[model samples]
Structure formats: C-alpha cells, structure tokens
Target: MSRGLLRSTAVFSAMTLLSRIAGFARDTLQATLFGTGGAMSAFIVAYRIPNFLRRVFAEGSMSMAFVPVLNEIRERGDKAALKDFVDHMAGALCAVVLVVCGLGVLLAPAIASVFTPGWALDQPDKFAWTTQMLRITFPYLLFISMMSLAASVLNSFGKFALPAFTPVLHNLTLIAAMLWLAPQFDIRPFGLAWGVLIAGALQLVLLWPALGRLGLRPRLRAGFHHPEVRKVAKLMLPTLFSSSVAQVNLLVGTVFASLLVDGSQDWLYYSDRLIEFPLGLFGVAIGTVILPHLSRRHAATDAVGYSGALDWGLRLALLAGIPAALGLFLLAEPITATVYNYGKFEAFDSRMTAISLTLMSLGIPAFMLSKVLSPAFFARQDTKTPMRAALLTVAANVLLTIAFTTPLWLYKVEGAHGGIALATALAGIFNAWLLWRYLRRAGLLQPQPGWGRFSLQLFAACVVMATIVVGLRLWIGSWTEIAQPTHRIFWLFVVIGAGALSYAATLLASGLRPRDLRH
Candidate 1:
C-alpha cells in the first residue's frame, strides 16, 4: 500500500476505535439504566427509524452517488463547477431531508404505532417517551445527512482524518449527556436523544472548517435543475431502494421482536451493538478509506491498482474480522457480564444477551466482507446489480426469520433470541455471497493468488484464539463465587489479554506481517 493510503487508514482506524469505545460506554449506560424492558425497546425503535432513514438517504445512497461523481468533477472541472455542484446538491438534500424530518416529527406517534405496535399497546408511557424523543432527534437526520455530504467531499479530496474523526465528537457528546446532563433532567434516556441532535450539529460544524480549507464554502443555490445534480439524483434513486431494503428488513425484525416478549427488542439491540463495535471499527473505516481510492483507480482504468486495493481490503477484513468473531463467540457471556451486568441488567438478561451475541458473531465476517465488497460495485457505478442483490437478501431474511422463528416458538426455546440471530446471520451470508458473485461476474473483482494460504492462516489463528478463550472462560466460571466486580473485571481482562496474545503470536508465526496490510 502507498504511504498515503496507509496513513489514511491508520488515522481513520484510530478515530473509529475511539468512537466504538465511546459507543460501548453509551450502550453500557443504556443497558444499566433501562435494562431489557419497554423503555429500552421504545428508545431503540425511536432511534432506529431515523437512523434507518439516515442510512438510506445520507450514508448509503447519497455518499455512494456523490463521492465518485465529485471525484470525477474535481479531476475534470474547474473550481467554479465543483462549488456549484456541491451547493446545488447540498441545498436540494437539505430541503428533502427537512421535509422528511418534518413529516417524521409530525407523525411520530403514528409511525411508532406501525413499527412498534406492541410498545404502543402495552406500554403507553414508553410509547409516549419514544414519540417525544423521535420528535427531538428526527432533525438530526437532516443535519447528519448534510454532514455525510460534506464528509464525502472532504474524503474525495483525500482529507479523511477530519471527517473520519468527527464521529468521535458525536460519541463524546452522547457520553457526556448520559453521564452528566441526563441526570439533571430526570429524563436520562431522553437526554441521549438530545445529545444526538447536538452531536450532529457539532459534526457538521467541524466539517465546515475542513470544507473552507478545501476552498469550498457551501451556499444554498437554486440549481436543482443543474445537469450534474440531476445525475446524482438519478443515481441515488436505485441506491436508495437498495439501501432501504436492508433497513426495512431490520425494522421488520424489530416488529417481530417487539411481539415476542417485553425485553426481546432490548436483547436483540444489545447483541447487535456488540457485533457492530468491530464492524464499525474495521469494516466501516476500511470501506470509507478504500472507496474513493477504488473509484479513482476504476475511473483511470488502472486494473492493477484496483485489484491491489481490493486485495488489501479483503486481507485486512480477514485479519481484523476473524479474530473478532472468534473472541465474541468464545467470550460472549463473560464480556456481556463484565460490561453490562449492572443496575437493572441482571444475570438472566446477560445470559440471554450473551446467547444472542454468540449467534450474531457467526456472521461478523460475512457482514464485514459484504461491507468491503459492495464498494466494488459502487466504485464502478453499478448500483442496479447491488440493488437486486439487496432485495433478494431481504426476501431471504424474511423467509428465514419466519422459518426459524416458527420452530423456536413451537419448542419454547430458553432464549428464543437465537432464532433472530441465526436468521440475520444466514441473510448476511447470503448477501455477502451474492455481492461477491456479482462483482466477480462483472469483472470488477478478481481472486488473488495465495488466498488459500490466507484462509489457512486465518483459520489457525481463530482456532488458537477460540481454544484459549473457552478454556479461560471455563476457569473463570468455576470461580463464580468471587464477590467483587473488580475481581470479575480483572479476571476477564486476563483471559481476554492472554487470548489476544495467542492470536497475535499465531498470526505472526504463520507469516502474516503488518506490511501485508499495506496496499
């Protein structure tokens, strides 16, 4: 890898690590305060609806369409054309996001009714809290969408550190709110919602200085009719459908989870959060840094560069993802207990959540690989193919959910959360496979030599990590009479540290080196 790409990846990875840590703190706070109950479920539902929209409009569709085109314009056009295109797109996106958010705020109750009807029926107070929280946080969707646009521009300009680190600001703000401000208001969970809005504003403000540094001062322009703007709109439509399908499937799962039991949504939410920590840290950071580089290489017809970038991304994904999946699977119980076994979160809740976490870990690699691979299509501007794949994945997820849930419901499984986790994992694997096949068929992705060796080494590392982690957990379990939380946390760290050291030693012994991570 070039020093520039490595530097960018490292910077982004560090920032992502901090953000994920803060996110864990935030989740820990939520788990303690709300536990596996109606309030937590309502909060998850409220937060998810807008977040789902953010993914569709802001993170997924908009960035995928805007970044490559912006890069192309920057390469071909003058400063004036670039500024005009950004201004027009920004204004148009702001208008659309504002309108949608307005509708969301106004119809928060009704929207909540449809997606989380069980909450509305059984826990009126929880439903009301969710409605109000949604009203406050809905506007964050608009601000963050604009932030996504600005960040994409900066990233295309190769100024990745600022945009990548800006998320840390959001996480910090939420952590502060949860620790300090929320208690002052007696609406602890609601305070987190307010923190989200403030964080979005902060993220946008942070990027504005970066935009100015890039000689781009965005101003509202009546240029929706601009041809370039229209092109972005045209590209975004299919991508939106593609992106929203995944969100829709998740929302459907949430609905089913709501009906399952009181704490089911919370269990699923916590488990998903655990898996998402690594996914966000490595998968998202790598994807963000790799996309523009891949797009540029594809645009320049640099086949070797494109292939190298893909290879490095896949290799890095395996290096980071496989160990994470194994660690989560083996230490799910201890990790959950150590992080979240407090306040209203009891032993039973931790056990249930650990079960879900273990099941979800099985799909971590598949999920990360999908994140890494989908960009191959996006870089080539072939959104239609991924859209088809995404739709098919959603259908498969729905069918699998029904299939799995039926048996679990019939047998009254101890933690019925396993079915949801399994369904999601199966769907994710399907999604990854379809994307890989499509990219290969389109000639956008090619298999590299030594993949067999990479797989073998990775498998060996996972085996070593899993064996140590499981043995350590068994040893710790035998000493359950340890009275202090400090003792528990200390032993947890010892086991985790030893397992990590073993994995690292095994990887090094197998001939994988830090240099292999470079492009």
Candidate 2:
C-alpha cells in the first residue's frame, strides 16, 4: 500500500470498527432477547434473503463492475460525461432493484422455503414467520443496493469515510429496534425485520448528500443504451455470479443448518457474526479502499502500481488476519460467553457458538485473502476467472457440508452446527487458493520483495499472540464458570489486549516496522 492508500484504508477501517462494535451490541441484544431458538432462526434465514441479494447485486457485482469503468471515465477529465454515466447506471440499477424487490416480496414464501426447506415442511411456524419477515425485510435490497451504488461512486472519487460510516446507521437502527420496537411486537424479531427495512432507506438517504457534495448526485434518468451502462451490464453479469459465491456458500450453509436441530441456524448466525467482526473491521475495509485504487492503476496500465497494491493488500491481510484468526481461535469461548450468554442465551448455547466460531476462525486468512484478491481480477475486467473459482467453491462446499455434517447429524453430536461452520471455513480456503492460483497464472499479482521475511515475522508475531492468549485462558479458567459477566468481560479484554500488545511487540522485535507496510 502507498501511504495514501494506507491512510485511506485506516480511515475506512476505523469507521468500520465503530460499525462492528455497534453490530456486536445489536447482536448481543438479539441473542439476549431470542437466544438460539426458533424465532431467531426464522429471522436469521429471512434476513439472509435480501442480504444475499445485496451482496450479489449491490455491493459485490455492481460496485466492482462500476468502479473501474467510472474511474476510467473520471480519469479522462470529462465531468459532464462522468455525471451522465452515473445517472444512466443509477437509473438502470434502481429499475432492476425495484423489480427484484417486488418479486422478492411477492415470492417470500417460496424464497423462504428454498433457503430453509426443513422449516417449510416440518417447522411451519418458523416457515410462516420467515416468510412474513422476508416480506418486510426484502425491500432492504432496493434501498441498500442504491446505497451501495452511491458508496462505490464516492469510493471511486476517493471519498471513503461517509460510505464506511453508513453501516453504523444500520447497526444503530437494529440496536434501537431491539431496545424499543421489539418489545411491542408479538413476534419480537419482526421488529428487527422492520428495522432492516427502515435502515435501508436511511442508509440510502444518508449518502445522497455525500453525492451532492461531490456534485455527482444521480438524476435517476433511464439510459440503458448508454455505452458505459452497457459495459457495466456486461461486467456485472459474471461478476454477480462470481462475487456472490461466498453468499451462496452461506446460503448453502443455511439450507443445511435448517435441517439440523432447532438452534442450528441461530448458532451459525451468531458464529458467523462473530467471525465477521475482524473481517468487517479490517479485511473488508482494506478491500473497499483497494478496489478503486486498483481500478485506477489498471486503467492507466500502471502495472507496477497495480502489482504493488496487490502485494501490499495481501501482506497487510496476512499481518492483520493471522493475529485475528489466532486470537479468535484462542478466545472463542470467552468471546462468545462475554458477548452473548445473557438472558435467554445459555451456557450451552455459548459453548456451541464458540465451537462454530473456533472452526470458522481457521479460515480467516483465506477469507481475508479472497476479499483482497478478488478485486485484482475484477479491476482488470476479468470476472470469468472468479466465476469459475466460485463454482468450484460452491461445489466443494456442498460436498464438504454433506461430508462433515452427515456424521454429526446422524450420530446426534452435541455441536453439530460447528460441522457446517467447519465446512464453510475449509471451502473458503479452497476458494481463496483457486483465486490466488488464477492471479498467479495471469501474472497479475507478483509478490513484492521482503515477503519471505515479512511472512516469517508475521508468523512469529502471531505465535507470540497465540501464546499470550492461551496463557491467559489457562490462568482465568473457563468463562462459563465465572460468576460475573463483568469479570468475564474484563478478562476477555485482558487476554485480547495482551495478545495484541505481544503481537505488536514481537513484530517490532523481529524487524517489522511501520514503514514495512508501505509499498
């Protein structure tokens, strides 16, 4: 990363950290209110429908497809032309989102059934609740897709803070719902669904002024035949399928989880949410900052800049991901026990969630690598390669999900949900491996000098961090046995702070410097 890129990434990461903290609070409240129960499972699955679409169409596909093209146009120094392109793309995307949202609402029951097959047949109450919430939450796709589009535009213009902060609105809305609206609802999670709907609108509204400040506010004019819009359409098609593989894998997990015991979906949901903390704070923040930067370099045929960006992103991902993965693996139980394990959430539920979190933590490196690397191909307008990788990943996940989940389910194992999380984690590595392999074959990503030493140093630091966490865990005893939540929270922070401090100290002692992160 260049200093400029690093600064931008830091800005985004800080905002994302705030958002993740708020998200943690929202989730903690949700777990308190619902626990790993039928209602929580229903909301989890119902919410997945639009969230999946948001990833596929809004953020993943359209944003990736739009940024490079927009960057090129902006680089050409034609503000009027750029504005025209933005308007046409906005109109086209909004039209598609409206149609999709309408269909999603209309077919909520079928959509609910497809993702949660076990619920539709054997768990009718869960099924009905899922469908109802799906109908309420599905419009989130429309609002959030537009929000994503606006954010991509801002990112392309080198404006990242507002976009990064938008998710805080989402978490705040959900937290507010949990505190107030949920109590009024007969079905408590229903309030969360409504909150999703409201937050989507608020997120989109929040970005309009940012766009206006840039004098790039879209006019919602139909121009499907505009050359740039057509190019974006072509790029979005394969990218949609390609970039959505992760979401697809999650959907696959949800399908299998639905068939497991009653609390399986909730377990996976909470575990995945915990896994997302580090990912959201660092992995995604880095990826978001890098995409437009890579797009600009790729457009200018600046191979050196492009390669350096990729190298920096990969190394930084490892630098951050390794410690995070290790910390999560070491402190999974305590993290779960502290963040959840209140009210309706029990010690058993915390144990199960921790099991899943630990298994999922094993894949953090792969997940972050994929998050940073995919944009390399996307920036070069090569979505087909990633689409191929995504297909293989989905297939592998299916086989693995079945392979790992069958015995657990058949034998009635205590932590069967962990099997699904384990499969997802393993499949993520395969997906990331394929992506890295393709990037190598295409000669798009070249490792920068010092990578070998950097890797060694990173490994050493992570080892130190892991040792500290393990030592702390041994000294503190099991979290569930702790009498007070406040003490559990204190010890959890002690372990995390000590591990982080040790990791940083070891990295410095091993000759890794702040300057080493620079490209």
TM-score (all chains, Cα) for each model = 0.95, 0.99
Tens-digit lDDT string for candidate 1 (1-80): 45567788788888888888887787877788767775567677888888889887787888988887787777776889
Residue pairs clashing in model 2 are none
Per-residue CA lDDT of model 2 for 1-519, tens digit only, reads 489889998999999999999988888889988787778788898888789899977889888889889998988999999999999999999998899989988998888989989888899998999999999999899999999999999888788999999989999999998889888999898989899999999999999878998889999988689999999989888887678777888899999988889898888889899989888888898899899989989888999999999999998898888888888888899999999999999999999999999999999999999999899998998888998999899999999999999999999998888888998999999999999999999888888888778878988888888888888899889899997889988888888999999999999999988887875
Shift in Å, residue 79, candidate 1? 1.9
Alpha-carbon error at 506 in model 1, in Å? 1.5
* Candidate lDDT (C-alpha), each: 0.82, 0.89
Kindly report the root-mean-square deviation of model 2 from the true structure over all alpha carbons. Answer: 0.9
Candidate 2 lands at a TM-score of 0.99
TM-score of 1: 0.95
Candidate 1: lDDT over CA atoms?
0.82
